[model samples]
Target: IYHVNNWYGVGVGSVVFYNDAIDANTDRSLYRKDHVYTTADKIRAGVALNNEFKFGLITAMVDWGVYLYNPARHYYDNPEHPIYGLGRRPLFYKNDGAGSDEAFHYIRFGMKTRIWDNLYFSASAKTHLHICEYVEFGLGYQIPFLKKENRKHGEKIFHHRKNWWQE
Candidate 1:
C-alpha cells in the first residue's frame, strides 16, 4: 500500500492463491466445484487494485475495490440446471477471455464500520461483470497485537482544535 496522504492510500497485489478459504464449508471438498460454494472459490492467482480513505479513530468508514476474475458456478443461466451441484455439467469459473457472456473480470465494493471500540461490522458485495453473486456480512475485532506507538500530542489541522489522538 502507498499512502497518498494522511487519509488516502492505494494498493495493488498479485497472489498465487487467493481463494476465500474462510468462506468454504469445511465439510465439502475444494477439488469439486459443486462441493465448494463461494464467489472466491477459484484456486488461481489474482491481480487487483484497491484504495481507501480514513480519518480520525477511523470510525464509520466507507471503501471500494476492484478485483479481476469471477467465481462462476453459472447456476442461473439455464432453467434446467439445478442450483446445487454440477449434475454432470461443467464448472464455470475460469475466464473465457474477452466476451460478453463470460466477461474478464468482476468488481468488489464494500464498507466496514466500527460498532464499538475494536469491534466492527462489515458488509460487502461481489459483482461478476453485471451479475451480482452475493452480499456478505461479517463481524470482526481488531486485536492489538503490537503495542501502539506514542502519538504526537496536540496536533492541529486547518486551525481546528486538536483531534484524532486525544481519544
Candidate 2:
C-alpha cells in the first residue's frame, strides 16, 4: 500500500547571487562609507529530484546547484570596533570564507501537466522553509531525436500514474 515515485535529471540553469552590503561611519572617515557587492552570469549545474504522491497532482522536488566559480567581485563589511576602530573586512567575497561555497540549495513543491503531446508547462516555488525565493513558471517542449511514434517509452510513466509510491 506504499507508493513512491521519483524522477532525477542533470541540467544547467542560470543563477544569480545577491551580495549583502554594509555602511558605517568610521572614526578616521568623516563621511559614511558605503559598499555594494554582487555578481552576475553565474552558471549552476546540479541534479534535481521530484517525488509524487498517489491520487494527487502535487509533486515535490529538490534541487542542489554548485557554482562553478566564485563571484567576480569580492564583498567586504565595515564592522565598528571600540579598540581597533571601524575597518572593512572581507565578507562573502572570499571563495573560502564562511557560506561562500557558491552553492545554492532549495526545494520546490508544485505540479506540472502537458499542454500538448510534446509541449508541457509547470509551476513551482523555490523556498528555504521560511522565505520564498521566487515563483517559477516554466514552459518546455519535448523534442525527440526520432519521430514521435518511434520514440521509446520508459517502463515507469509518471504522467499516467496515479500513485508514485505504489509497488
Clashes of each: 0, 6
Which lDDT tens digits does candidate 2 get at residues 35-127?
Answer: 332234222233344454433333344444333343322222224433223443222223233332222344656666665545667787765
Model 1, range 42-117, lDDT digits (tens) per residue?
5444566765555553422322333333343342234343543343334334433333233334566677666664
Worst 10 residues of 2 by lDDT: 19-28
Q: Looking at model 1, how many pairs of residues clash?
A: 0
Give TM-scores for every candidate, taking all chains together and pairing residue i with residue i: 0.45, 0.45
Please list the C-alpha lDDT of all candidates, in the order they appear.
Answer: 0.47, 0.41
- State the weakest 10-residue window (summed lDDT) of model 1: 152-161
For model 2, the superposed segments whose C-alpha errors exceed 4 Å read 1-33, 37-60, 70-104, 155-167
* Native RMSD of candidate 2 (Å): 9.1
